[model samples]
Target chain A: MSAVLETRGLGHDYGSRKALDDVSLTLAPGEIVALLGPNGGGKSTLFRILSTVMDASRGEATIAGHDVRRAPADVRQALGVTFQAPSLDRKLTVRENLIHQGHLYGLRGPDLAKRVQVMLEAFGLTDRAGDYVETLSGGLARRADVAKSVLHRPRLLLLDEPSTGLDPAARRDLLRLLQRTRDESGTTCFLATHLFEEAEVCDRVAILDRGRLVALGRPADLVREVGGEVVKLTSDDPEGLAVAIRERFAMEAVVADGEVRMEREDGAALLTPLLAAFPDRILSATVARPGLSDVFFRRAGRAFEEGSDA
Target chain B: MRDQTWLPAFSLWQREMVRFVRQRSRVTGSLLTPVLFWLLFGAGYGGSFRPAGAPESSSFEYFLPGTVVLIVLFTAIFANISIIEDRREGFLQGVLVAPVSRLAIVMGKVLGGATLAILQAVLFLAVAVATRSAFSGGGPGPAGALEAAAALVLLSMGITALGFVFAWRVDSVQAFHGVMNLLLMPMWALSGALFPAAGAAPPIRVLMAINPTTYGLAMLRHGLGRDATGGPAPALAAAVTVGFAVLAVTAAVLVASKRRKTA
Candidate 1:
C-alpha cells in the first residue's frame, strides 16, 4: 500500500544554517512514527515542512497522494497538526475553540456542535467545555489542542512534542489518548519528541542527528543494534583506564561523564578484566543491558543531554 | 469543484464571525476607544469650534461624523493586532494548515474585522444620539440613514482589508504597529476627521486628496449633508476604495498562501 505521508530528499535552510538536510521519511497508514533527535537536529524544521508551514528548500513531499506544494489544500485537508506551543485562544471556551476549528474545516451548524460535543467527551473536556481556555491546567490545554486537531478526523495527524509540559499522569493519559486515536480513527501519526519514553511508545522510530538520519527501526531493534550488554567502569583516571582496557583486550570503550562504558558479550567477564587492568585506579563498575540512552550514545558518540546540539 | 470551493470559504467566514462574537472584549474595546475620543475631545472643544458652513450648529454636531469615522479607523487598524498575536501564538498556523483556501482565510479575517466595525459603528451611533438630543432631533431622514449605512459598510470593508494586509506582511506586533501608526495617524489627521480638509495648507490638502480615508470620510460627510464632495462622485470614491482593498487583500492572500506552501 502507498504511504500515507512521504518526503523525498527534503532540505531547508535558514540563511547560512542548515535546518533540514537531505532528510527523507515515510509513514504508513495506522503506523505511529516517532522522530527522535537532539536539539536543533531539524526535527522541528521537518515537522514544519510536512505540515505545510514552511517550504522545503529542496525536495518533494506528498500527503495521501497529493503533492504538498501543488495541492496544499488537499494535503491540509488530509492531515491534522498540533503545534508545540499552546495555540488555544485563552479568552474562548474549550468548546468554542473546537467549534471554530470545525468550521474552518467545513463542519458547521448542528454538525459543528455535534463534533465539538464528541471531542469534548472524547478528551474528557466535557465538564470544562464552557470554561475559558486560560483557566485550564497545562495538561487539559494540551488535550484540548489535540482535540482541536482531530475534530475534522483527518487521515493523518502530526503532533510536535505533545508531552512537553504534562505531568507523569497527564503524559500517560495523552499517550493513551493517542493510542485510542490511532485505533479508532486509523489515523497515521507522526510524533516528534526528545523524550525517549515517548519514542519507545511508537511502532517505529527514526533517530536523527545534526540534520542526518542516524538510525530507523523499532525501538527494541534499535536497542539491540547497539550490541551486547554494556559495562560501565569509573576510575580516577577514566581515559587512562579506557585506553588500557582497549590496548589489553582490543575492546572499544567510550569515556563520558567520568565513566568508561564498553560493549561485550559477557559483561561479567569484562568486569574482571577491567578491575584487574585498572586495579587501584578503578573506583566502581556496573553492568546492564543497553537502553535507549546507551544506543543514542553509541550511535551519536555523545550523551543525550538537554540543549546540546548534535 | 466550485461547490467544494465555496463550502470551505463560507465555513472559514463563519468561524471568523463566531470568533468575533465569542471574544466580546475585542468588539467592546474597539467601540470604547472611539467613544472616549468623542467624549473627551468633543467636550473639550465643544465651545470653541464652529462649523465652516453651518454657523448655527454646535461643534459636537460638526464633530459627530468625524468621530464615528475615527471609531471605524481605529477598530480596523487595531484589528490586525489580533492577527499578529495569532501568528505568535501559532493559531494562524493552525488555520493556514487546514484544508481551506488562502483567499478564504484573508476574506474571513477581513469580513470578521468588518463585522466588528459595523457593530461598533451602530453602538457609537446609538450612544451619539443618546448623549446629545440634537443628533436625535433631526436624525438623517430614512434615505439619508440608509445611505449612511451603505457608506459605513463600504468604509469598513476597505479599512478591514487594509488591516488584514498589514497583519499579513508584518509578522511582528511592533513592526505592524509602527507601520500602521506611520500610515494611519497622518490619514486620520488629514482626512477631515478633526477639521475640514478643504481649508488645510496646499500640501496637506493634496495629501488628503490621495488618502483613502479622505474618500471614506467624504462619503460619510455627504451622507450627513455636510459635504457634496462624495455624492456626485460616489462611484469614483468607491472605485478607489475598492481598488485599494483588492490590492491589499490580494497581497495579503499571496503572502499567506506562499508562507503556508513553504512552511
Candidate 2:
C-alpha cells in the first residue's frame, strides 16, 4: 500500500526566522506517528502546512496521493485535522458541531445523522450531545473537537497538540479512543505533540528541534540508540566540568541546568573514574537507563523542557 | 463533480441562524440599540430641524427609513462579529480544513450575516408599519414597502459583505469594534442617514456623492416615498446598490481565499 502521507524537504519561514527547514517524513496506513517537538520547534508550522492552511516557503507535501499545495480540496477530502485550540463552536451543541462538520464534508440526511451518532458514542459524548460546547469541561470539549474532525471518516487524521489541555485520565482515554478508531477503521493518525508521554504511546515518534528532524523511530528504539546508561553529574562549575570530563575521558558531555550528562556503556564504571579524576569538581552523581528525554538531549543538544514559544 | 457550493453554504447559513436564535442577547442588542438611537436622535433634532425637500412630516417619521437602515447596519456589524469569534475560537480553521470551497465559505458567512441583518431590518420595518409610525400622514403603498424590502436585501448583503471583509482581517472583537467605529460609522453618518445631503457643505456633498452607502439610504428614502432631491436618482441608486454588493462580495471572497506564509 502507498504511504498515507509524505513530505519532501518541507520548509517554511516567517520573514527572517525559519520555522521549518528541509524536514521530510512519511507515514504508512493505519500507523500512529507523533511529531514530537517543544514549542517553537516547527511542529505547528508543519501542521499548518499539512492541513493546507498555510503555504510552505519551500518543499512539497502530499496526503493520500494528492499534493497539499496544488490540490488542497483533494487533500482536505482525505484528511481530518484537529487543531491545538478547541474548534467546536461554543454556541453549538456537540451533536450540532458533528452534524455541521458532516455537512461540510458532503454527508447529509440519515447518513450524516448515523455518522454523528457513531462518533458521539465512540467519544463518550452521547450524554453531552445536546449540551452546548461552552458548558463542557476541557477534556469533553477536546473529545467533541476530535469527534467533529472524524465525523466524515477521512482516511488520515491529523491532530495538533492533542494532549495540551487534557488531564492524565482524559489523555489516556483519548489515546485509547484513537487506537481503537485506527484499529477498527485503518485510518492513519499523525499528531504534533510536545508531551513525551503522548509521543511514547505512539507507534513512532519524530523528534524535531529548531526546524530540524533530528531523530525518528519507535520510542524504545530511539532510547536504545542512545546506547548503554546515562550518567549525570551536578557540580559548581558544570560547564568546566563538562569540558574537563570530555577532554580527559575522551567522551562527549553536555551541560544543562548545572548538570553534566554523558552516555556510557557502563555508567557505573565511568562514575568511579570520574571521581578519581576530579574529586573536587563533582558534587553529586547519578546513573540511569536511557529514555526518550535522554535521546532528545543526545540528539538536540538541549533538554526537551527548554522550549520557547513559537 | 457534485454541487459542492450550496450544501455547505446552506449548512453554514443554518448554523448562523441557530446561533443567532440561541443567543438572545445578540437579538435584543441589535434591535434595541438602533431603536434607541432613532428615538434619541428624533427627539433631539425634532423642533430644530426638518430635512430639506422632504414632504411635511414629523422628526420621528423622517428618521424612520434611516432607522431601518441603522438596524441593518447594526445587525451587519453584530452578525459579522461571529467571524472574529469563530477565528479566535478556532472554529474557522476547522471549516478551512474541510473539503468545502473558499467560495462556499464566503457565500455561507456573507449570506448568513446578510440574512440576519435583513431579518432584523424587516422586523423593525414591520413594527413601524404596524404601529402606523412609518407614515404619519402619507406613506408608501404596498409596492413601495416591497421595493424598500428589496433595497434592504441588497443593502444588507453589501454591508454584511463589507463587515465580513473587516472581521476576517481583524484578530479581536475589540479591534473589530474599533474598525466599525472608525470606518463603518463614518460611512453611515455621511450616507444621508442622519441628515439630507442638500444642506451639507460642498466637500461633504462630494463625500456623500462618492460613498456607496449614500445610494443605499437614497434607495431606502425613495422606497419610503420621501423626497429624494439631495440624493442620486432611484435607478442610479439601485444600480450602485447592486454594484456595491457585488464588489463587497468579491472583496470578501478574495480576503477569505488569501493564503498566508505563516500560521
Candidate 3:
C-alpha cells in the first residue's frame, strides 16, 4: 500500500509560541494511526494542517498525492474530517443536516437523498431522522457527525478526539464503526486522542510531546521495548535513595513526585537486593510490566503524569 | 447532470428557513423587535414631527421605512451569527475541509441570511401598510408593495454580506456581537432609518449619504410614496443598493477565501 498521507518538517507557531516544531510522519492507505498526546501537544495544529483547514507555516504535506498547499481542494476531495466539537446544526433534523452536507459536496437530487438515507441507517439515526439534532443524545449526535463526514466516501478519514465525551458503550460503538468503515470502504483512518485506550486500538501510534514526535511504533512494540519491568520506589528521602540507587546500579533514575523510577532488565531478581541496599531510606517499592506511560517516560524523561515539574 | 452552482446556496437557504421555523424565539425576536420600536417610538414621537424634507408626512409614516430597515438589520445580524458559532461549534471546520469553493460558502450563507431577513421584514411591512392606510390617508399599491419587498431583500443581502465580512474573521460570538454594536449600529443610525438626512447636522447628513442602507431606505420610501424624504430618485437608489450588495458579497468572498496569510 502507498502512503495516503505524508507530512515533512511540519512546523507552526502562534506568534512567539511554537505549536508544532519540525514534525514529520506518514500513513499507508487503510492504516489506522493514532496521534496520541496530552492537551497543548500540537495534535490539533497538525490535524488542521493535514486536513487543509489551515496551512502549515513552514513544511509540506500531501493527502492522496495532492499537496495541501498547492491543491487544497483536491486534498479536501480525498479526505473526511470529524472535528473535536459537535458540528451538527442543532435546529435542523438529522436528515436535513446530512442532506445539507451532501449538497456541499455537489451531491443533489435522487442521489443526495439516497446518500442521506444510507448515512442515517449506517449510524442508526434513521428513527431520529426527523428530530432536531439538539434533541438527540450526545452519542447519536456524534455518530451523525461521523456519518456526515463519511457521506462523501472519501479515501481517508480524520477525527480529532472522537471519544472525548462518549460513554464507554458509545466509545466502543465508535471504535467498531471506525474499523467497519475501514474494512468496508478501504478508508485510512487517523485520529488524535489523549486516551491510551483509544490509541491502543490503532495499528500504529505516534506519540507527540512539546510539539515533537517523541515515540512512534505499534502500541505493544512500544510497551515491549523496555525488555523488562519498571521498578518504582518511594522513599522517606527520595534524593538519598536515588543517589544510593545510582551508586549501586550505576544507572540513572527519574525522580518525580517524591518517587524514583527506573527500568531494570533483571528488576525482579534485584528487587530484594535494592531494597536491602536502601533499607534505611526506602519506604516502598513496586515492579510492573511496561505500559504506554512507561514508554513515554523512557522517551521524555519526565513522568507521563502532568504532576511532574517539567 | 452535475449539481448546479446554486445547489449549495439553495440548500443553505432551505436550512435557514427550516431553522427559522423550528426556533420560535428567533422568529419572534426578528418580527417583534422592529414592531415594538416602531410602536413605542412612533407613539412617543407622535404624528407632528415631520422632517424638513417631507413636511406633509406623519412621524409614524416617516418611521415606516426605518422599521423595515430595522427588521432587515436585525434579521441580518441574527441569521449570520451562525458563522461565528459554526467555528466554535465545529460545523465550519467541516465546511472549510469540504471541496466547495469559498465563493460558494459565502454565497450560500449570505443568501440564506438575506432570505430570512426578507421574510421577517415582510411581516413588519404588512403592519406598516395597515398603519399607513389608517393614519397617513394613502399607501403603496400592490405593485408598489412588491417593489418595496424587493428593495428590502436587496438591502438585506447587502447588510448580511457586510455581516459576513466581520464574522468570517472573528471566532467568538461575543466579539461578533461587539462588531455588530460598534459598526452595524452606527451604520443603521446613519441609514436615515431613525431621522431624515435633511434634518441632521451636515456631517451626519454626509454619513447618511455615504451609507448604503440610506439609499435602500430611500428606495423603499419612494416605492411607498412617503414623500421621498429628500432621497435620490428611486432608480438611482435601486442601482446603489444592488451595487452595494454585489460589492459587499465580493468583499466577503475575498475575506473568506484568503488562507490566513498572516500565519
Candidate 4:
C-alpha cells in the first residue's frame, strides 16, 4: 500500500516570517507518528497545512494520494482532524456533535447513529452523551472532540496537541483510545505533540526545530544514535565548569540553563575524571541513558525546551 | 464515502436551530427590540406623522410593516453574527476542514438565519394582524398574505446573506459590531423603513432608490396593500429583491471559499 500521509519539501511563510521550511516526511499505513516540537517550532503550522486548513507556500502535502491544495475535498474525506483548540460545539451535546460530524462525512441515518454510539462507548463518553459539551470536563470534552472526528472511520487521523489540557489519567486514556483505534481499524495516526512521552510511544518521531525537520526516525533508534549516556552537571559557574571540563578532558560541553551537559560513550567512566577535574565547582551531576531530548540536543544543538523562540 | 452537499448543509442548519432554541435570550431579544421600537416611534410620531397618499391610518399602522422588517433584520444580524463566534470558538475550523463544499456552508448558515428571521417576522405579522394593524387598507387576503410571505422570505435571506459576508471577513465580534453599526443598521434605516421615499429630500431619495432593501420593504408594503407610490412597481421590486438575495449569497460563498491565511 502507498504511504497514508506524505509531504515533499513542505514550507509556509506568514508574510515575511517563515513558519515552516523545507520539511519532508512520510507515514506508512497504520503507523503512528508524532511530530515533536516545542511551541513556535512550526508544529501548528505543519498541522494546519496537513489538515487542509491552510495552503503551504512551497512544496506539497498529500493524504491518501490526494493533494491537499488541488484535491482538498478528497484529502478531507480520507482524514480525521482534531485541532489543538477544542472544536466541539459547546452548545451541542456530545452525541449531537458526533452525529453532525458523521453527516459532514456523508454518513447518514442508522449507520451514522450506530457509529456515534460506538464512538461514545469507545471514548468512555456513553453515559455523558446527552450532556452538553460545555458541561463536560476538559478531559471529557477532549474525548468528545476526538470521538466526533473519528466517528466516520477516517483512514488517517491528524491530531494537533491532542493531550493539551488533559490530566495525566485523561492523557493515558486518549493514548489508549488512539492505540485501540489503530489496532481495530488500521487508522494511520499522526499527532503533533510537545511531550516527549507522547513522542516516545509513537512508532516514529519527527523533531521539528526552527521550521526545519532536524531529525526523523524511530524513537529508540534516534535515542540510540545519541550515544551511550547523557551526563549533566550543575554548578554556580556553569560556564567556568564547562571550560574546565573542555580544557582538562578535551570533551565538548553545552552550557544551558545553568547546567553543563555532555553526551559520552562511557558516562560512568567519564564521571570519575570529570568530578576530579572540577571537584570544587561541580555542585550536582547525573548520568543517564540518552532519551528523545538527548536526540533532539544532538540534532538541533540545543536543549529541547530552548528550541522554542519564546 | 461520497462527499455530501445537502447532507452537511442540513446538518449545520439543524445545529443552528438547536442552538437558537437553547439560547432563550436570543429569541426574546430579536422579538422585543422591534416591538419596543414600533411602540415608541409610533406613539411619539402619531400626532404629526402620516404616510403619503394614506392619511387615514395612524403612524402605528404605517410602522407595522417596517417593524416586522426590523424583526427580520435583527434576527438576521443576531444569527449571522454567530459566525464570528463560531470562528473564535473553533467550531468553524472543523467545518472548513470537512469535505463539505463552501456553498453548502454558506447555504446552511444563510438558510438557517433566514428561517429564524422569517419565523419571527411571521409571528410579529400575526400579532399585528390580530390587532387589525398590519395592512394599510385592511387585511390583505390570502393572495396578499402569500405575497407578504414571499417578500419576508426574500428579505430575510438577503439580509442574512449580507450579514454572513461581513461576519466571515471580520475576525472579531467587536469588528462585526462595527459592521453592524456602520453598514447593517444604516442599510435598514435608509431602506425607506422609517419614512417614505416620496417625502424625503433629493439625496435621501437617491439613497433609498439605490438601496436594495428599499425594494424588499416596498414589496412588503405592496403585499400588505399599503401606499407604495414612491417605490418601484411591485414586479420590479420583487425582481430586485430576488437579485439582491442571489448576489448576497454569491458574495458569501466567495468569501467562504478563501481558506484562512493563518491558522
**Ranked by lDDT, top first:** 4, 2, 3, 1
Q: Can you write out model 1's per-residue Cα lDDT over B20-125, one digit (the tens) per residue?
A: 6777776666777777777776778778876454445666766777777777777777667878888898777787787777777777767666666777787777
Ranking by TM-score: 4, 2, 3, 1
TM-score between model 4 and native: 0.96
Residue B137 lDDT in model 3? 66
Off by over 4 Å in 1: A233-241, A247-249, A257-259, A272-285, A306-310, B1-28, B51-56, B133-137, B228-235, B260-263
Listed in order, each prediction's TM-score against the native is 0.91, 0.95, 0.93, 0.96
> Deviation in angstroms for A40 in model 3?
1.7
| Residue A203 lDDT (model 2) | 98
> DockQ numbers for every candidate?
0.49, 0.81, 0.66, 0.73
Q: In model 4, which runs have C-alpha deviations exceeding 4 angstroms?
A: A272-280, B1-3, B132-137, B261-263
| Interface RMSD, candidates in the order listed | 3.3, 1.2, 2.4, 1.5
- The number of the candidate with the highest lDDT is 4
Q: What TM-score number comes out for model 1?
A: 0.91
Q: Lowest-scoring 10 consecutive residues by lDDT in candidate 1 chain A?
A: A301-310
DockQ rank order: 2, 4, 3, 1
Tens-digit lDDT track for model 4 on A72-173?
989998999998888999999998999899989898999888888888888899999999999999988998998888887888999999899888899988
Error of 1 at A19 (Å): 2.2
Clashing pairs in 1: A53-B263, A54-B262, A54-B263, A55-B262, A55-B263
Q: Candidate 2: where are CA atoms >4 Å away?
A: A243-251, A269-284, A308-310
As for candidate 3, its clashing pairs are none
Give chain B TM-scores in order. 0.86, 0.95, 0.92, 0.95
lDDT of 4 by residue, B122-215 (tens): 7887887777755545678788778888898888888998999889988888889888898888888988789888888899889889899899
